[model samples]
Target: MTRAARPGAAATRPGFVWALPAAVFFLMFALTPLLLVVVLSFTSWDGIGEPRFNGLDNWTALLHDPVMIQSVWTTLLLTALGVVTQTPVSILLGVWAAGHQRNRAVLSAVYFVPLLLSATAVSVVWRAVLDPNFGVPAQLTWLFGDGNLLGSKGGAIGVLTFVGVWQFTPLHALIYQGGARAIPQVLYQAAAVDGAGRVRQFLHVTLPQLRNTIITSVILMVVGGLTTFDTVLILTQGGPGTDTTVTAYYMYQKAFKGFDFGVGSAIALVLVVVATLISLAVVRLSGYDRMRGTAEGL
Candidate 1:
């Protein structure tokens, strides 16, 4: 015969009961605000009195706004640069660190230093360092006798891309390093027995094992690129004629500076949709969904 249930045992049993507090917190903080944003996006509010219902007006404006379109293109460009530059560098560094323990500490310290600095601090330091007259960049560009990196369109994008890559690649490297180390040593041994060299082993064994991690890293970096504003705002103020103005900063300007919260909310929601689509594309392109059941079957 089963023992009689203790008082409140059913309520205290192993289940989502323990998650109630966190679920409550998420509902109160996250879900509520998100719902409010969605509601507000459909209304016309100027951070003042009444929020009049104005359906799709802000979204319609976004479709034709040249500045919004430019900001979107800029955001995509930065994200593409981050993916292209950071992913390979991170994988290479992670592989190097995982394979060789001798300099791992030094490498990790060097790579992670930028991440420790606040974005504003980093931007301020870089701004000083890139000063056209007296900065290191000036000295370097003295070879060609043309300096002014922060002034030109291509140069502004390049600096923003460099900063994005510099700050983010270390996190991706840590992800890859963890993934590399988690791989079974027996697999490497078997690959070696089959005449696989280091490069071939990496290509065949390491990369396949780290595929999910890489996909996760790509999604994170892409999202980061889409939402990046603090560094660009602090450094360039989206200056040199909006060359570095990403959608995030544009949203901020519309919301705070221009006092157009409805438009900003629409832009924020659009960014959310765009980010979701891009993340799904990354997952599909990396074949993450296809790899799901194979591991369980194995």
Candidate 2:
């Protein structure tokens, strides 16, 4: 007769069997490409040719590259503007919609419509809206007479930021709405009993409760803004003199247009590092681990 398996054997078996496949898949698909990119960053390669090892030459060149530097700055600016502009609006709309349960479905659907459209579609629509000569701006100019909104730096950045905010606020609003729903109504009732007004209740109860969701939404928006390419490419193509070329777009131009694969890889690697660091920093700052701990405690 066979001996009975030990108590911990079953638990170990599943993990051991699963671990090998998961590790193999990760190494083959994920880690291997990352390693190749890291290796390529140190080599000079045109798209069709073999790469020649050049040590840190690509990175060194990137450091002195004006366009790359501007792209990085623009990306950071866009991310900052996106978060600042979108977060409060999303939270306010979410809280309002959640509070007004009667109109929650209609309002949520209205806000989420933009997110359903592809970036290309949104960019095309907005391009016409912002066009100075024959679009909505022109119509407005006819009423108000001759102002080129898309031509000016401030106006251009404002339009980009506005588009980013409009497209993403709905996503965050939905996330926040879910978070708001999860909040126990008894807390609101208690706050009301203590003579707290709507704004006070939101500050004291809703904001703190929805902190984790807000953190997550902000992280998503920031990353999207940082790496944004399609909408900017369609709308501005880093136009008005490189005002809107984000790091991702810059890398695309470097790899494709300039045909500097090695330098492009280095820039892409820097973007990955930046995104990873920002995500980690946000999670830590927002006390994401604390939420995990609470869930574990429960």
Candidate 3:
């Protein structure tokens, strides 16, 4: 005999049949290319003749390369910075925008314009704005010193990190905004009845409700930060020395510029492995993978 379904519970969770198409597509596209890259990583090829198997040469080279190590650290540092800077701001803006206030509609429209611009466009605009000749630093020399924001290591990294935060924060904000809107209003009303103030409501009611959303947003941010490419290519070009030579750009240089496809493939494979491991760790530690119910209604 069938048991009666409980009210407010998910009536019909998506089954494996619903996911078959995407699974097939992923296997055909993503997994196929990944396997090809794995094979290429084990071979020496310059994009000319047939690739010759080189075994552990490509792997061992990157293991001992000082620049490679530094690039890994830089990638991790930028990713960490992005999470730290973007999370709170995104949450605040998102929660605010989730309100019924009229100003929110107007402000959100203007605030979301940055996401319309491509990474290349963002980089170019920022580069012009920071130009030593006539950019903000030039006009405000006393404030900006020499106006060479991309000339030095710290300045270059700062610009890159800021640009990343600026361009990507809106997207994360949208995610949080949606998550906030999805929360049951009864919870907030009950909290209000309990004499919970605005700050208390947010801290206790909103944040806990958005836990899964936060996990999702953070996973996206980590992946985006790890694989940031176009901005680095267009803005800094991994220049002013290798100060900004992140792993992605370094792979580009090795593969395209240096004409060492083998090494580049090896680096790319390693990046994929590292990103996967870190994402799994986040899911595991957050207990997102072990839970069964949704984040709301608590």
**Top lDDT: which candidate number?**
3
Could you give candidate 1's per-residue lDDT for residues 1-298 as a string of tens digits?
Answer: 5999899998768898789999999999988988888988888899898888899899899999998999999999988998999999999988777765667867776877877888888888888887877887667874525667778888888888888777787888888888888887888898999999999999998888887888888889999988999988987788789888899999999999998999999888889889989988888887887766313322
Best by TM-score: 3
RMSD values for the candidates in order, in angstroms, are 4.2, 4.4, 3.9
Off by over 4 Å in 3: 1-24, 292-298
Which stretches in model 1 have alpha-carbon errors above 4 Å? 1-15, 143-145, 290-298
Which residue runs does candidate 2 get wrong by more than 4 Å?
A: 1-13, 19-22, 142-147, 292-298
TM-score of each: 0.89, 0.90, 0.91
What's the C-alpha lDDT at position 168 in model 3? 90
Looking at model 1, residue 33 earns an lDDT score of: 84
C-alpha lDDT of residue 80 in model 3 = 93
Task: Estimate every model's Cα lDDT from 0 to 1.
Answer: 0.85, 0.84, 0.91
Q: Which ten residues in a row have the lowest lDDT in candidate 1?
A: 289-298
Q: Report the Cα lDDT for residue 260, model 1.
A: 90
Query: With candidate 1 superimposed using the best TM-score fit, by how many Å does residue 198's alpha carbon deviate from the native?
Result: 2.1
